[model samples]
Target chain A: MSTTQPHKKTSGAYRHGDLKKALLGAGLALARQGGPNAVLLREVTRQVGVVPNAAYRHYANQHDLLQAVRSAAMSALANAIESELAKLPSINDPADFARANLRAVGMGYLKFAQDEPGLFLTAFSVPDDLQGTAVPEKAGNSGLNPYQLLSVALDRLVDTGVLPNERRMGAEYLAWSAVHGLSMLFIDGPLRQLSPAQRQIVSQRLLDMVEKGLV
Target chain B: MSTTQPHKKTSGAYRHGDLKKALLGAGLALARQGGPNAVLLREVTRQVGVVPNAAYRHYANQHDLLQAVRSAAMSALANAIESELAKLPSINDPADFARANLRAVGMGYLKFAQDEPGLFLTAFSVPDDLQGTAVPEKAGNSGLNPYQLLSVALDRLVDTGVLPNERRMGAEYLAWSAVHGLSMLFIDGPLRQLSPAQRQIVSQRLLDMVEKGLV
Candidate 1:
């Protein structure tokens, strides 16, 4: 079990309050390798050179640790979205900006899923009512979580008259269903074997469908 | 261990050729209860009143059994789509009938995902290259698999001029992405708690998006 150590650090005891962070680091490493199912409390503690009881001092159970890891994963996903949003060139038209914002959010989401599938899967491993829960832990440097970012993009569309006010009610679900479904298909479904070039084509096509369909 | 027996038959030995079918029956029961991961050889054999080795004769390994169960689940999903297709009233207008056919396929998929989430999850547990792999085992009564059924609907759209022939190349993926993504969100993601009426509304809206987007 010790053969595949999480890091090259010696198996020394963690300094006072750093154990939780250390355990979380180890858990993230595990999730990066395998997916949500890989982040076990025992494995995390062992990787951190501590006993499982020490982990319990920070997290009540494996589920609690998983939740923490999931939050971090969500934050990472938000950061990915922010990175894409930040890359947009200044647009004069509000409609073009709104359209670009929505596309950036989706492109960021697909890129994250492709690049960090394990963490991506871990981020959504547990279900939560994400309708309006804008907790800071899941936020990016822009102070918005992934879902909130999507809502903002859609709201921009409505404001710009690109997407009608009446159609904006649950447009999040409609758009999210398309992008998220394509991500899942790319990551874990039959499309898993698609080449990166093929994936790019399909991804663009899916986004086109969402943009055209939503409005 | 036997408290939740797969069937009410006594712990008697199986007849020569009946063991394979009995084991598959038990495996399907397990899949219905807990999705793909639940179909274990040991548990299946135990449920079938046979030793572990008895299962090896039928299934080379757990994966082989899971493949069978997944195929069965695929067939079940195809049947659900076919059942919805059967409900369509013969219309005089070709375009209207084509549109209705596509909607019926999407509706049947969503209904099956809601009504049989466990089996739905099990069906998509493994990632096989589903493009053009129309095997007999996964076919419905109409001799069409789920992917093929979606393809047929999309083809009908082009045939009736509801969808442009140029856009018909990969419209199946676009439509499947929306319907499948919505299904996953309903069953395992943040949208799991949506009420049936709300789900119904969302389902129609998603189908609407697909129909509009595809064309």
Candidate 2:
């Protein structure tokens, strides 16, 4: 897809204006194989068949490149949640819809971690300096980051009067922590041994617990 | 500390049975400096003035040594939690004591992560095979791993008649996940930026959420 057309080759200098996107794609591929640790700059340059200098033009440093990849990961995670949200049957009542939608947010989150463990890790492990920059929901381009989506879901709970306004303060942290912990345990801890069916039961139970705990 | 006494230096062969302990200590120090990756066998041996063969005698591979380090980390974590439990005011009622004790457990976990972030990472990042083996509560001699402590707390909730038998099927996961997520976020996620006072507030709020959510 990056091959230049003959008509566009009139200029002597090489022009890969979409180099940033290519580099990010290569970074994601590297992360997929060896995790965040693998997204090295020179390696990414080689993967994209670009000279180191060209890659540098797009990313000032490895951290910059990783931040972009993390942002992409956030977008992917949000899309995964969106997929789950789509799978749910239509809900009539506002509270019921909010609750179901929030549950879908968590289920999508867990499913993404389970299915795309590497991406999930890279997404959440955005390095210290680059964190706020890659926030999925705040990404001017992407519709919502995971945290923003979670916040929206929690807002719905408050709006429906399911959770008191006083209790709603930082309610997202409670639900997020529970779901995130389960995902890490499932992907990187002892829970990795659970069979798919057992995992489903456990996931549902965990979400149920989070729902109950938050309200 | 493993240095041989002058009186016992007649033997040409070096026999340090404490080599394992020294290696594990060195491994923990390395992890402290650079997380799990720095706990390499060669580096550990170099740190302890031992040859690779001597290190190999105690640990077949880096993973084995890491597992030992992870176990030590768990022991350290249990000690930290035990330390917190000791600081609690004496409560006459079993239920009240249990509640306070459970809260201490979460506080200790967070404190450990905040104060000794490196060790906390090593403790929870126990290599897959070493996971159940290094459980914080089941350290045999240590009295209770974190899981068992959580279970005891949940048992208290059930005993207090606050939570029904059906509701307590797996309440520990709820509390553990919430607390663990908070720790991870504090140490490695965006929550790292929060001030100590802010963290304290959030910590108490999260624990309250867990307490309320479980029942």
Candidate 3:
């Protein structure tokens, strides 16, 4: 993260170590209401009932805070996928296993967007500058980021011989674009007017297309 | 568009009729530089060398101006697709014509995003209100708006029996999602690192998937 001039505060360490966690929770709330634009360092500190000067310790600037929020978003997305996968029936065939897992990835993604449109958007709102902070490529408490989870699911498709080896190089991107498009269209585009039941049908149709296209 | 209290200026008609066109051109430039956020009413007037209060004669408010810009964006996108289609060979078979037209639409959409990322985004950035603006539902000088263009291409697919009737209802949304997602990823996501030639390959791969899935 890019550094700014240090905040002039002798009591910078006065807050308990929980201050970082508090700031993130408040930031998420702001993002929930106003999208990425609402995630300001000063605003989060104010919401956390801390001196504005103390924000620098946890985040160098707004960009640093945004990256952390994005990381949290990825974890939340991964957890959503896991919850969906856990509810599925046990797989008896290798091909069905591959298809179910792949379909679950998309279903989980679309369902998460339906349930938490705010967090879903925050997950991909890339800032103009990341200040060299690596994206949360590492798994958080949820055990996987979105990219890792998707990669694993696609690998299963190859392992089951459902996806030909020659077509695997960029399959993740193709599948991801379709699912992401459906979610965004539902959340912010013309599909926002659709009833929940109708949105669900569209989601299934999109998933069907993704599966057909991949294999 | 949302209504604002009318500007209290007595000299509303002092400027020539060219002011409206001048403001839209300037607004498009701002959108080109900074997506939706930069297309401010005051800023557009400022760039156009007009009094801030004078903007109301042309636009009720920012939302009103945004709707106009979006209309222009739709026209621009349609024109981009037409330019691409013009370069293609004439096909005699109805099925081949349908496929080529659909492919051209996606290619045009992606190319427009690559060429004018800001305007491309501003085009789809729906305003909070769209009360009375003439959306590009009718054919413009460019021949179509983005949605109308897509509808025409999809209609051709069914007319030629290239796509089955049962799959026709929501197929446009599915196809749109794939292409839109690909363009968004190419513009702002991890795919931004791809070189132009590399992007070309990915674009074709996505179109192949889209065509296969739709048929």
The per-prediction tally of clashing pairs is: 0, 8, 1
For A1-215, candidate 2 gives per-residue lDDT tens digits of: 66665234354336666878889999998876566767889999888777777877888888888878877877888888878878999889999999998999999999998888777777766353322342244331347777877788888889998878887756778888888988887777667788989888888998887778776
1 against 2, candidate with superior TM-score: 1
Q: For each model, chain A TM-score?
A: 0.87, 0.86, 0.87
The C-alpha local distance difference test score for the whole of candidate 2 amounts to 0.76
Where's the lowest-lDDT run of ten residues in candidate 1 chain A?
A: A127-136
RMSD of each: 6.0, 4.8, 7.0
For each candidate in turn, the TM-score is: 0.86, 0.82, 0.86
lDDT of every predicted structure (CA atoms): 0.81, 0.76, 0.79
lDDT score of model 3? 0.79
Task: Choose 1 or 2, whichever is better by DockQ.
Answer: 2
User: By DockQ, highest first, what's the ranking?
Assistant: 2, 3, 1
Q: Please report, as a residue range, the 10-residue window in candidate 2 chain A with the lowest summed lDDT.
A: A131-140
Question: Which lDDT tens digits does candidate 2 get at residues B17-83?
Answer: 5888999899999877666656789988987776877877778888878878877777777778878
- For model 2 chain B, where is the 10-residue window of minimal lDDT? B129-138
**B31-117: candidate 3 lDDT, tens digit per residue:** 877777678898999988788878798788888887778778767888888888787799999899999999998999999999988
lDDT of 3 by residue, A1-215 (tens): 35654444555645455788888899988876666767888899888878887878888887878778877876888888878877889999988998899888889999998788777777766455321333457463457876677778889899989999888856777788888888877777667888999999988888898888887
lDDT, ranked from best to worst: 1, 3, 2
Q: Pull out the clashing pairs in model 1.
A: none
lDDT over C-alpha atoms for residue B1 of model 1 = 71
Segments of candidate 2 deviating more than 4 angstroms: A1-19, A40-57, A61-63, A126-142, B1-17, B40-46, B49-54, B126-143
